[model samples]
Target: MKIWSSEHIFENPWELVVRAQWRKYPNKFNQAVEGIDVVDRQIDSKGVLRSHRLLSTRWGIPDWATKIIGSDGVGHASEHSAVDPRNKTMELKTRNLTFCSKITIDEKLVYSPHPEDKNKTCLKQEAVINVKGVPLGSYIESFVCDHISKNASKGREAMDHVINTIKLETVELQKEAKHAMESINLNFDI
Candidate 1:
């Protein structure tokens, strides 16, 4: 078994960081994540939004590991998340569904406003890995943990790209709306 944890701070506001997280897929930075499907979503009585998602991913496993596992490296994981707007907090938990007999990876993440800077967001992440019935289990666990650390950096880059895209889209929409208003005013003046 291996445990890994990390903390990071994003310069963007908490709301924008959380928003970017929802749209983090399909970006150039994290190509390993192939797809995401929302399985369920709802709002609770206290106004917290809850969501369950299934993620399809290819982790770029080594050739030797693939040979040992006797299968393609493609995998699926189920994620459950909760967002509390009132408190400006987002929490997510994910667990692998594939290769359960040989290995299991469980992850947890939390996003919240930075205590020192309200405009910044702080992310806390932890992952646990266990390998059963596998040779060199400890080595495999260490490799997975290292891969996760690298992927976490890519995840941040992806979030930055998403946030930039969102800002650009917002600006474009505003310009379009302004143009429509001007056109309507011109028609009225005629």
Candidate 2:
């Protein structure tokens, strides 16, 4: 299924803050944003899948005001999963501030057997947006140099306006989607 995707390139530190905030708290409102659940498996040198449970948890800021005020989160939950050879890793290095940006949203519905009750199943459809960037300009060449001084006073106001608008749009879209899903009887599990 097609998923809604949105992205903005950040040229100024203030813009970066906004982008980071959205990335850090895509579901700050506790809405179940759609996406695939990845279960990673690790492989040993002998090419055998390891059977150990990777236990990890990440913590995050829980205050709406903090998000609105542009306060970054406190901690990140460690990802719990096994690593496998099927995973691909790419490494690229460059001087800061030279890059392109892209965001992709994917939606899918999935079903898996309940861990506690073998006979039961769980169904969830998620919308996930992945973001990537490569620097496009030097920090000095970008707006940072010219706007830094003014940003101290103007950043907060601009951020508040942008964030408020985004929050409102998210709420309306979520409500509409939820209602449509319910109307089709696809909002809950079978």
The candidate that wins on TM-score is 1
Worst 10 residues of 2 by lDDT: 89-98
- Compared with the true structure, all predictions reach lDDT values of 0.94, 0.35
Off by more than 4 A, model 1: 62-67
Kindly list the per-residue Cα lDDT of model 2 for residues 83-102, writing each as its tens digit: 22233111111111111133
List runs of model 2 lying over 4 Å from the truth. 1-147, 186-190
lDDT of 2 at 121: 34
Model 1, residue 108: C-alpha shift (Å): 1.0
Please provide the root mean square deviation of candidate 1 (C-alpha atoms, Å).
1.5
